[model samples]
Target: MKICFAVFSFLFFSSTSVFAEESVGISVTATVEGHSYSSGGGGAPVPVPVVSYVSFSGYAYPAAKVYIESDSQNVASLSAGVDGLFSYEVYGITAGVHDFSIYAQDLNGNYSQSVSFFVDVPSSAITNVSNVFVPPTISVDKAEYGIKDEIKFSGYSMPNSSVYVVVNSTDGSLKSFSKEVKSDRNGYFEYAPIANVFNYGAYLVTARTLYGGVFSSFGSSMDFQIMGRTSLFASRPRCSIKSDLNRDCKVNILDFFVELRWYKKPLNKEAKKRFDFNDDGQVDLADFSIMAFYWSR
Candidate 1:
């Protein structure tokens, strides 16, 4: 029995490896071998089909990379569409209760906490797992801060939603603080400390977004240390305004030119995430006029 098990393991490990395609927002496929009947194996064994069709669909940060894992092994990796939506069909899975985990990394390089679940798949059966929302991509601008310096917390989540930022002292040298920040129409959010509300110590920060009055799970935790004497200068929040396209923190001619590329054009969900200022599903004079309001801001 032990020799048979060893031989089986060797055969499995020595098989060809498959890789995911380098494509954005597409289904992932792989090949796996199924068991077949052998006439000279001492006895006739029943054949079992290994094919299982399962699809996973969900939302994450815009243009983010979504990864899928099963039993500590990588299954598939794909990018979310511009609209923050992603779906992938996994092929060559065996029929069983398979454990799976999903996570995403936003365009800003922030990685959200993973969402895990299991699926009871039958041979030749089709199953779909949808509405799997990846948690907010979270980050801190810096890993160390002065006592009086503003700690900027930023991330991406559902557009037009409310983000809850939580700050707590990991070493108990400071009090826990939390507040609600608003996500912009494009799902980017940031909160920079405006007052000298911190002490000398190590702190942890986390964030989550509320969609339709429902809050999502808290994402991965980030920590920072406040060392040495404090600085008297208070850090000001950057111009993270929604209309600042080029991210130069200013709405000027450069931003205008970027927006004009989609001028008067029918906008898709991804395009609307950045250009659809009015949420009318179209980019026209109305959207451009709104951009005019923030010009030079």
Candidate 2:
């Protein structure tokens, strides 16, 4: 009887070991509108009125319980299907970045490692698609300027509307500069610093139009550079389109007119160097193709 008991104990230990080895941990994968998440990726900046959806799907031990959370708030809890597949969706996320976490627990009470993702939501106050409000537009006099040099920043908005401007250094170290002014009778407004008063570096300027104390959710932004002694080595301002003649941050009919006016005209050395998108010694259809690629972008 003692020998029989010893044999039974050995068999029990071996079976327990086999059970532990067969129990695999869960695994998860997720996306926002079919795009996988990445740290600081910012996803695609979308206007606020559009609905954003996040979907989580993954494999777990068959019949396992899966729990998903957004910023630690439990958003979903469900059981994996017979094939070990589990899926869930969270909707109506508000403006700003949000964090999503998902994990699973098997029948054996083993918990899987949580998978996390980040999504960024841009501000948009428009609720009706048909009545979309067109925000004001802004522009800078030039792309690059010397430190302390006067730079004229201007834009168009609703007549008599208030415009708020915010300027910040791109290097991520300095405090932002801000000012408020009213649009003129013709819906035009301009702001120039009293003095350069800004550190020498790349800067981003954004402006929003305000009406009756409410401001546009997604304001317009532009980039410019403050040239320093070492600016030659610094990053240059990005030009989305070589044919943006008015520098209004777009290539549209205005640019087409500028190109038409200079079509086949004798090009100055600077104009040839800057406007010659094709590098074939002139601005022509070849350059127009490049501009068309970025139209309305």
Candidate 3:
């Protein structure tokens, strides 16, 4: 009986060893939609149209879990199919260089060596390469702001041309503020909106060139925020009640309109100082609550 038991154990150990040997390891290879940096692929930064999205595709071990990382942050993950293929799309990638890394891990927890590649999104200001005309560029002086502060929106365009500026909510649901400003001899222009033109929230500011009364496509936008008065002065009643964006001494639809114009976008330093109701550096629902509290008051 003992001899029979030893024979069974040996058979079991031999079968397990064969199964382990048959298991495949995880492997991954990836590339940007238009770039090729792989081995034997001439290392060149492929030029992609300056757009807001980028797609990545690659192969991994079948039935493996794949992870896509950007700037050391895991942006996305997916499961490899029977064909050992994976693809992912990243949205709102602004003009710049981005490094994306990918790796795979099999069900048995065996990980593949990470593969990485860089994608370049050229600036809209960089024209003349493909006969494609990119519009002018605009920028805010800072990222946040206070209630009664002046914001300097500046940019460059064709020399002595007319540039139109638009400040609106990032969500595209609010009334936008628009103005036409002229560039100088050097193609530089600046627009300083009236103090308190924006209310407690975030905003997207964009600029486009005007030729013979026709506006060109807007270039990339600048994001900024306006903070709530309560955030600026938590202990002072006089300042706490300063949510009156229209300065009519009351917060009403007019003020709400101001808030709507810039809601749900990023903020500048000065705007953030005013709109970050909770002083959290973000103009989120918490800050909106503060604005709602002063509604019609």
Give the candidate number with the greatest TM-score.
1
- Candidate 2 TM-score versus the reference: 0.37
Candidate 3 residue 145 C-alpha distance from true site, Å: 0.7
What lDDT does candidate 1 reach at residue 34?
46
Model 3: lDDT to the true structure: 0.59
Model 3, 1-297: lDDT tens per residue?
Answer: 999999998999899967643322222222223332334467665555433355556444455677776665677888766544566666655566766656556444533434444656543322111111124557676566777777888866545678888899766655898888987755567899743786767788887666434344565556677664323332212222345665664555676666665677788997776566676777677766866654432
Off by over 4 Å in 3: 1-131, 171-173, 212-214, 229-297
Encode model 1's per-residue lDDT on 1-297: one tens digit a residue. Answer: 999999998777666221111112223332334454445557777676544567888777767889887754678999887677789988877778887778887777655777766766666655677777777877777666766667778899877778888888876766778889887766788999832577677778888766664556677666666766553432323544467777775566788888899988777888899888778888789878877655532
Instruction: Single out the weakest 10-residue window by summed lDDT for candidate 3.
Output: 125-134
Q: Please list the C-alpha lDDT of all candidates, in the order they appear.
A: 0.71, 0.60, 0.59
**Better-scoring candidate (TM-score), 1 or 2:** 1
Put down candidate 2 lDDT per residue, 1-297, tens digits, no spaces: 999989998899899966643332222222223333334456765433334455556543356677777675777888766554566655665666766555555454433334445545443321111111224456676677777667787765445777787788877866988889887755567899833678777788876656544454323457787775323434435453466777775566878878877677789998887677777888778888866644432
Q: Is candidate 1 or 3 superior in TM-score?
A: 1
TM for every model, in the order presented, reads: 0.57, 0.37, 0.34
* Candidate 1 regions with alpha-carbon error over 4 angstroms: 1-51, 172-175, 228-297
